[model samples]
Target: MSLLFNSYPLARSALFSLDAETAHELTLSSLQKAYDCRLTRGLMASRPEKPCRLMGLSFRNPIGLAAGLDKNGAHIDALGNLGFGFVEVGTVTPKPQPGNPKPRMFRLPRAEALINRLGFNNKGLDAFIANVRKSEWRNHGGILGLNIGKNAATPIERAVDDYLIGLEGVYPHADYVTVNISSPNTQNLRALQGQEELTGLLAPLQEKRKALADLHGRHVPMVVKIAPDLDIEQIDIIAALLPRYGVDGVIATNTTLSRESVRGLPHAGETGGLSGPPVHALSLRVIERLRGQLGIAFPIIGVGGVVSGKQAQEKTAAGANAIQLYTGLIYRGPALIGECVRALG
Candidate 1:
C-alpha cells in the first residue's frame, strides 16, 4: 500500500459524517489547494509505468480518473498528479447550469456506493476550455478526456445542437471527447440511447469530427458513454451501430438506476444512478457482452464499482481496453491508482 494513503481511513470517517456533496466539495478544494502548494506530488506515491495504447493514443497506464469528479476541468493537474494514466473532466454543456439542487448527492457507505442526480452541473464550455488550456498537464503529453453533455433546458429534439456545440468547443483541447448520452439525471437524456435516437445523435457528430480532424490536422476520437441498465439486446444494438457510425470507442457504462443490490439501504430510495461495488458485476457483464459483439479491435473503457486492484483486473479481463475510477476514489483514496497499475502491470 502507498504510505501516503495510510491516513485515508481517518479522513474517510470524518468526511462520511458530512453530507455527500459537502464532503465532495471539501475534498476537491483541499486537493486543489494541495496541488497549488506543490504538496500533492510529495503526498501521493508515483504510479509505476504500465503503458497501453487505445484510441490511437498512448496512456501512461490503463487506469484513468473518470468524468463527473471534475465536471469543469478545474483540477486536471491536481488529479493527473495522483497517478491516473489519464484524467477525464466535465460533462460540460454549452451553457452553465446549477443542476438539480442541494442534497442531490447521497452516499450508501455500507454498500460503498453513491447516488447522485447532479444533472451535468458545470461551468459551461468557455470556462471548461479555459481551465483545460490552463492545465500544466495539457502540454505535457498526459491524456485528457472531455466528456460533454447537453444543457438541461435544451429541448430533447434540439439536443443534437448542444452536443455539436460541445464537440466543436472541446475538440482541439481534448485527447478524446465523450458524448455522454447515458446519464440518468438529465431529463430525457437516456432516450437518446435508443436505436433511432442514437443514430440521429451520433451520425452528425461523426460528420463533424471528420471536418474537425481536417481543420485541426488531428483526429480526436469520440467515445460514447452508456448506461449499465441496458439488456444484452440493447448492448448488441449499440455495439452494432458504433462501427457503422464511425464512432471511435465506447465507455461501457456511466452509472445504473437499479437498486436491487442496495435495496433497503439508506438513501436507496434516492432517484439517481447508483455507482461503486454494487454496479461492478453489471458493468463487467456489459463489457464482456460488448467485447463479444465488437470484437477484439474495438476499444472499450470500463468503469463502475472498481475499488481495488482485483476489481480493476476483472474489468480488463472482462474486455476493457482501459478502466476509469470515480466512486472508488471516494472510498479508497489515491492508493487505488497505484494498486490498479501494479495489478495491470
Candidate 2:
C-alpha cells in the first residue's frame, strides 16, 4: 500500500477532495501504473485459497471487482493485481458518447455509498476491446468478465442490437459477457427486465452467442445484470427466463433507485442510483428470490455493499455462488480483499 493508502481515512480524504468522476479516473490510472510496475503483484500472488467454480468458470476466490469500476478496460491488470478473483469491465456502447454531463457521480461518504447517474460512459466498444488486447494481465490468468449495455439514446425496442454488437466485439477476449439491463440512468432501460421484453431482448443475443461460439471455437458464458429494486414477481420472472434464454448466470443487483436508508443524508437528494450498505438488503433479497425460483443449479454473482468478510458470507448464505464489490473498496481499501477471501474460507 502507498504510505498515502495505509489508512482508509487518508485514502478517502485524498480521493474525496477531487471531483467524483475525476477521482475515479485518477484512482484507476494510478492503479494501472502500479500494475505496469508490478508493485502489487507480490501481494496478489500470496492471496489465500478459496477458489470458486460456477457456471463453467473457475475463480481463484469469490471476491470480484464489479462492473462500472473500470468501464473501459483501462485498469484490468491493475485490478487483477488487487487480488480480485475476477474483474468485470465496461458497460460499453456501440459508440463513445459523453454520458450525462458534469457532476454526474456523487459520493455519500457518511453512508459509505455512492450515487452515480454516469449513464454508461466509456470509450465505446472499439476502444474497450483495444484496451483489453493491450492489457498485460493475460498471463495472470484471472477471469475477465465484460459488462455490456446500450447507449442511452438507443431505443428500448432496438436494445438487443446494441447488446449483440457489444457481445460480438468482446466475445473473443472476455471470459464472460454481462448483458446490463438495469442501469437507472438510461431511460426505459430497465423495461427490458419484463418477462416478455426480456425474452425479446435475449432471443437474438442467444443466437449471436451461438454464432460467436462457432466463430471463436469456444463457448463463452453470458450473464444478465439485473436491478435490485424489482419485486419478487419480477425477480421470479428473470430467474425463470434466464436459463430459458440460454443465459449462463445473473448479476443479482445493480445500483438501486430506492432512498429508504439514505433518506435524510445530504447527498440523498442527488438524482442517481444508490449503492453500498443501504443496497445490501435488497440485493440479498433478489438473490434469495432468484435462488427459490432457479434453485442451486443456477449461478448467481452477488454484489452491492460488501465491505467486510461477514457481509460477503451473508451474500453467499443468501444464495450467491460468488460476490463483487465497488463502493466497499472505496471505504475499506485493497486489504479488504484478503480479509474477505479468508472470511469466505
Candidate 3:
C-alpha cells in the first residue's frame, strides 16, 4: 500500500499538470505500454487465483475499470493486465462523431472529480470492435462489458435503434452489455428515464436482446445505466420497469449534474457531468434508493466517486453487487485497484 501510494503523487503531479484530455491520452499510452510488457500475466499465470462471477461471466476481481476511461475498447487487454477484475469499454455510439470539443473534459483535483461533456466520442462501433478483436487482449478469464449509447444526431424517438445496433454488434464480443441512457450530454437524452419513455425505449432493445440470444444460442444480460438526478418516485418507476423489461442489472448513477460538494471550486461551473468525491454521497443515495425500491432480487453495479476501500465497502453495503471507479483511478492510480479489492475482500 505504501509503495502504491508512493507512485500516486508522482503520477498525479505529472498527469494532472497537463490539460485533462492530454493527461488521458498519456494514461492510455502508458497502459498500452504496460500491456505490451506482460505486466501481471507472468505473476498471475505463475500463481492464478483471482476470479469472480457476475452477469453470467467469470471475472478476475470485483474491481473493474469503468467505461469512458477506455471509450473505444483500445486497451482491454492492456488494462486487464493492470489488475482489474473486469474491464468495461465504451459508451459507444453507432456512428463515430467528435464529442463536445477540445476542452470538453475538465479535472477538479480538489474535488477529485471530472467534468466531461465528451458526448459519446469514439471511433464508432466498427472501429472500436476492430481494435478489440485485433488486440486479442483477453484477461485469460476476466469479464468484459460493452457500454452502449446513441449518437448525438439520433432523434430521441429512434434511440432504440442505435442501442439495438450496439447490442447486435457487441453481443458476440461482450460478457454483458450496458445500456447507457444517463449521460447528461446530448440533447434530451436523459428523457429516456421517464417511465413511459423508458419502457418504450427498452422494449425494442429487450426484444433485440432475446433475438440475439436466440441467434447466438445464449442469453446475454443487459444492464441499464441510470442518472442520479431522480426523485424517489422517479427511481421507483424505473426500478419497477427493470424486471418488466427483462433487464439484468442497473448501473446506479452516472456523472452527476449536481455541484453541491464543489459548489465554489474553480471548475464548478463547467457545463458537464461531474464525477469523484463530490458525487459519493448522492451516488450512494441513488444506489440505496434503487436497492430499496427494487429489493435484493436485482443486481446493482455501484459507481461514482469511489476512491478508497471504505467507500467501495459503503457502496457494497448500500446494495451494490460490484463497484467501479473512474476519478479515483486517475487520482490514486493502479494501486487504488489493489486497495479496493483487498478492502472489499
Candidate with the greatest TM-score versus the true structure: 1
The ten-residue window of minimal lDDT in model 3 covers 40-49
lDDT of each: 0.92, 0.87, 0.84
Candidate 2 CA-lDDT value? 0.87
Query: Whole-model lDDT for model 3 versus the true structure?
Result: 0.84
TM-score of each candidate structure, all chains considered together: 0.98, 0.96, 0.94
Candidate 3 total steric clashes = 2
Alpha-carbon RMSD, each predicted model: 1.1, 1.7, 2.2
Q: Write the per-residue lDDT of candidate 3 for residues 68-158, one digit (tens) a residue.
A: 9999998887777667777889989999999887898898888888899989989899998887777554537767888999999999999
Please give the RMSD of candidate 1 to the true structure.
1.1
- What is the Cα-based lDDT of residue 270 in candidate 3? 90
Model 2 RMSD in angstroms: 1.7
Ten residues in a row with the worst lDDT in model 2? 39-48
Q: How well is each residue in 1-345 modelled by candidate 2, as lDDT tens digits? A: 444335557766888899888988888877666666655544344345588788797888888989998889988887887778888988889999788987898888888999999988888999999999987665676889999999888888888899989999999998999999999988899999999899998999999999999999999999999999999888888888999989999998899999999989878999978999999999999999999889888999999999899999999999999999899988888878878898888
Off by over 4 Å in 2: 1-5, 39-46
lDDT of 1 by residue, 32-118 (tens): 887787555576636558998999999889899999999999989988988888999999999999999888999998999999999
